[model samples]
Target: MTALPQYERLEAPAIWREGPLAQRREVIVVFGDATLMIADGRSARALTHWSLPAMVRRNPGKRPAIYAPSEEEGEEVEIDDPVMIGAIEKVHAVLEARRPHPGRLRGWLGGGAAAAALALAVFWLPGALIAQAARVAPEAKRVEIGQQVLGELTKLTGQPCASRAGTRALTALAERIAGPSAIAVLPEGLKGARLLPGKLVVIGRETVEGPDTPEVAAGEIIAASLGAAQEDPLLRLLRYEGARAAFWLLTTGDLPETALAGYGEEVLANPAPPPADEPLLAAFAAAGVSSTPYAFARDPSGESVLGLIEADPFKGQPAPRPVLEDAQWVALQGICSD
Candidate 1:
């Protein structure tokens, strides 16, 4: 196989324009990588990315190279630093002289043929891989993983909710937003809501009970589900785990028992996923919910929500469904407390 560049520990000197109003002054140069990033500190936040070989060819070894913008021109600075310029020149020479391995050339050809075959299979079989994945990912395994995660979450929270009431309320809200056909399943570490292979909607309680109202919770659930509709949930899982994981899932029908434990803690600590316009709009219209609260909750500045606000799906009309009844609302909030 042709050896790709080893990028493990190499660090390159980055350049930046020092003074205010300097043009194309800042440059961030990484020595050994597929691509290079260049930032101009002179102008207001000017950044550019270029292929490594392309950048090397453009700057040749003579002096410090300044990349001037097409629209405006700026005076170039002379870089006489022997050490810094020498390093860059050496890397450029090495890149030019390096040749692809013969074995790697054959492997690349084989990989291309394999990729073409895989594409043909996917096109003709449509979801054959995903279906295969689901069978190997048994419902029993999912339920087991879900229960384990629930156990950890309860421990983290110091106790289970006063009752299953919080879960019931969440489920109710999910039903309202997803319509009666949707099912809400709670699992431990799914940082955000997930649409499972069996048309199941998986969510984490933190997102539901986090600052947003039931409407916001419902919006996220529907958004996740819509994304799943476009692609299989199992495929997403495979993507996260890689082709080996996909193969394992297909062969065994279940992800490893400890598969999601580590991620659970991270999900609890991070910011929740935002409800984007397309899915949010679709879910909002379907559930008769307003996008206002969800949008603001995601972006307090109101700038990120321009899309939602401008194309308000619930424009000038009453929202279709109440996310949760009064009793359910109280129950959901008191979930951990109880």
Candidate 2:
């Protein structure tokens, strides 16, 4: 077999079964270049080869490690050899790490383009620099930055409102409207809502308490999600930190503590800018939510958010589905209560 880069050749004794009812056979399992080779124990004849990427662990965290080509297929290999199991896991990790990140590639390309255009004019440099930093940033690094921002915001707003029931309700509501993301209700600071990196959505108590229906709160969450998708939160942070900080982030994937110290105050004092009408309406439509509730909530007169009110996605629908159940909505409303 050809030698694979970054992986050592390993062989171990394991029990192999062709199917659920097939009699177990002792086999010599060899980890080969991008494949697992099964050979007859006594004869040393190659039996079969399984693609390493297609291999799946059948029973995880169990005594004997069981594996299959796919979850739906019944053919399995049971290995008690720790060395072989460890090797398989390590190779899987390496492959996953090497997988392409489209966002990271885009960021690099954007940075190169911006640098090339820098001679033309210096005015466009800041926006391009911040965009490149945000684009190139890995998800893990973004999550860390988001956590730091949240911690800073907590200082001004106190810790996120939490009660077992209220948290459960909040989670359910977030999942319904915003997919799998953390929704934090702040007792103070934020006026309406803001989306941070790492899928954190922060909302003020007023957004929840002021609305008669959960749809209003849900709308705010959807709007924030849309805004974040349109404009990267990390890009905003890098811009606030300035060009020097943007360069540091691009090189080291770290932001200075002092750069973010006053960010929470700035975010709190400034109201979240409204998202574009077309995309915001599309977001509400996709989530099967009415924009009218949130529009009127933002402005009782509905004059400022006339576009949202006029183009309400679920406006004429006799009865749109509730954002949350009656009981869950009640719990969500009182999330800030002591």
Candidate 3:
């Protein structure tokens, strides 16, 4: 027996034609587990169900995407809704992936069609593969990659400062912001902070020493985390190495050492773009930290990041809770002294 198709249910408005000469009618398209259900927009009644596996895109790259139940069918549906189009494309891709491979003779006969498919796959496959790799990668592998990247980074920025007391304090701060996340204070080179795989956050010594309060350092950590959430570090690494490298890592669970050699330098030379104010403020609020100090630190005159200041999560409150005690802050400041 065949297994049931698993997919999310989605619905959107669509213009559908029953035949080549038939007039178009506005209908509601509902994407189901294994089929596309067309419903009467007014009566909310089912009109037809198109099997997802048999559906095909009639136009390759045209706006107002169109689809048909089969190539020989005269009926077609034109959907302008991006969400519905994306859902259809996703389901089509999944179905295609599960289809059986063509025979050797068929492959030779369809060489031209195969070439077109290969071209499209080349453009679309790598990102999807990289995303899948990042999602399924084991924690041990993530840690291994993080450690390797950190090691390469040390060559450019020198070893991360290490004092027993400072290390303890940094760990405390990291725990407060993100449980089980680790922070490393480098001697120099990093602008603010950069997150690595395995929940490792790297920071410049200045972030701790330049500010009087731990809130500044905490804010930077929050910012780095927010950036990482937007773009996964592993995905960036895979993209930099290209599809071949990504495929190799996907199959073997290891990245080529050469691919990561200059990554640290690249990160240090190019500062990460600041996260959006809404998300950044949300991050600060979630951590019970203030963004005012970080805003001032970014621009002493407070002209550029005025939004962060005006919308400070802890603004109206009486001096939000301290990130660390006086002694802990002092220890964290001296992290590079060793």
lDDT of 3 at 257: 54
Candidates' TM-scores?
0.49, 0.60, 0.64
Off by over 4 Å in 3: 1-124
Clashes of each: 12, 0, 0
The digit string of per-residue lDDT tens for model 2 on 238-335 reads 76776546656876678755668888887777645788899899988888899999998888898999999888887788335778889898888898
> 207-306, model 3: which lDDT tens digit per residue?
9989888888888888888887788877777666554456557767887557686787777776568999999999888888989999998999999999
Residue pairs in collision within model 2: none
Give candidate 1's error at residue 253 in angstroms: 2.7
Model 1: lDDT to the true structure: 0.51
The candidate that achieves the highest TM-score relative to the unseen native structure: 3
- lDDT by residue (tens digit), candidate 1, 1-338: 11124312122335544333674344434323444444443432435444444442225544555432222333223334342344334444444335354666767766655664454333212234444554467656655544544454544444433458777886677567654234343433444465544555555556556754676666666676667556655555444443333444555655555554554353345423544577768677766888777676657788978888767787676576677887898787666566
Superior by lDDT: candidate 1 or candidate 2: 2
- Sort by TM-score, best first: what order? 3, 2, 1
- lDDT per model vs. reference: 0.51, 0.77, 0.78
C-alpha lDDT of residue 23 in model 3: 93
Q: Over the full model, what C-alpha lDDT does candidate 2 score relative to the true structure?
A: 0.77
